[model samples]
Target: MGSSSLRVYGGVAGNDRKAERRAQLIEAGLELLGTGDGEQGVTVRGVCKRSGLTARYFYESFADRDELAVAVFDHVVSGIATATLEAVDSAPAGTRAKVRAGLATIVRTVAEDPRRGRLLFSPALSSTVLAHRRVESTRMFARLLGGQVREHYGIGGSTALDLMTEFLVGGLAQALTSWLNGVLDLSEEGLVEHCLEMFLAVQGGRLEPGDGAAGLQAGTG
Candidate 1:
């Protein structure tokens, strides 16, 4: 069928229908994978059952259970990362402002949808495909952070910046995991504030190519 004729079903296009089904499967995967049940929760049959779709529809979106799980993880991570970037872009200038803006967006995004939090850090992720994806995500965040830090510092290439970014990314991930697990003993606001401080503190350090953010302070973002 041509593209225009694909919209015959209640005015919804075939591609749109497929996208909806794909989203449904991903959301179902999120529910299963983010639960305390972990990796085992993301079977194809389980996803089909959870999404209230047939096996045929499930295969239409994902090649396998692992693919769906990976898609769910990527979706959540992409959501938070994209929101954080937008928040930072709209925020007022200054090191603290940018940091606070980004941090607050991340915390709020996951808080608004707790599933994203659990999906990213649930204990159920032990020694699974999700674990590997988590590591890869950390690297992506590190690159983003490192680039932003260098831009703020007006600095050039330096391995120390890379190291610092990795530390921040890994530390933040662990800290967020603790927070989500109820071991951090802090409210979402408190978590964001604390993390903002830490990020600014690190940004304040003197790297090889540029000076520290010596005069930055906590304020409106």
Candidate 2:
């Protein structure tokens, strides 16, 4: 290779290293947030200490705590979104499989790491980060609905899509938050079944007797 090619390759490698370090810092911050009482949350100093990087490095990657919060929130949510999309994309060509695949990702991702799920679904961050957190999730649900609605339901419209997408995002958020708060008793499998049953009900479809219940598991002291 020419000297110019070598220089370009070297620069690319350095950039990747920098990006990896930045991601590490962000992940460290997220980890700290998951620890402790969660009242203080994760501060810039705390993150720098946890990351073993200087405050200067944290600034080099993020402007402030809120900015870092956004980055951490994005990092976590995007991982879940990617997994959900892949599950939905590869599901068998049927409404049942597709819906199960999408909702299953939600429940599994939350249950996979209860701490991370709490952080992601908690009101522990700024309002801005909280608001933007579900944008990707909502978009994923919309895409998931786009294919299934047309194929199995034989229904298609911007309005219907918007409603179903809202239902999925809002419902999942509420379900996870409730479970985190001890209001809902939902196992990984149970949550997936309940969510799909609720979706069908909201879409004006009836639940079969053996499928699942739209009601919450009762009694919490």
Candidate 3:
């Protein structure tokens, strides 16, 4: 019985060490991929060096650099989603307030960690794996936004709502990307205000048909 207990303890210790190494690798990937140098600096050797782990440990955790990049992207997006949801949930009862809270959380998060912003929004980091994960994350956020629309405006799930949510999600993405890349020239508060106004317009049905194109233009400008 003592031998069996020792074996189980040894197994747990090994698993914990492996988990720690995996986390280190993920952090290294985030540092390399999320920085200004972008994906070019995310080689396995670079990550291993940054992580202070050997290549063998990297291979144990990820199949390749693309996988690591995707993991880092997912991690960043997950944190953003969590913070937004928490802010929205904790806001006082009002659709506008909740929306502002959520949007503010997102803007503040990116502003706090510009590296995460670049990892998430930079066109330069759009490798196939990262791009695919981006689309997935966008769809998830759109669904959350759709829920908010339904709760706030009594909109049912229909083709039109689906299309509207997609447009809103895409517009938000472009707006954030431009803001992060310095094209928008907006302060953090200004960025949140712009996004909040657009969301409010959508809720009020105030946006004209051509407004979507105009919004994209403004965001890029």
lDDT of each: 0.81, 0.69, 0.81
Give me the runs in candidate 1 sitting further than 4 Å from their true place: 1-7, 205-221
Score candidate 1 by TM-score against the native: 0.87
Per-residue alpha-carbon lDDT of candidate 3 for residues 1-221, written as tens digits (9 for 90 to 100): 44233333545765677778889998999888777477877899999999999999999889999888888888888899989988998999776788899999988998898888888888888878888888999999999887766665543565556677898889988999988888899999999989998987875643333344333223233
Worst 10 residues of 3 by lDDT: 212-221
Off by over 4 Å in 3: 1-12, 152-155, 205-221
Highest TM-score model number: 1
Cα lDDT tens digits for candidate 1, 31-116: 88766477776688888999999999998888988888789999999988888888888999877788899999888888788788
Better of 2 and 3 by lDDT: 3
Clashes per prediction?
0, 0, 0
User: In model 1, what are the clashing residue pairs, if there are any?
Assistant: none
Ranked candidates, highest TM-score first? 1, 3, 2
Q: How close is every model to the real structure, measured as TM-score?
A: 0.87, 0.75, 0.83
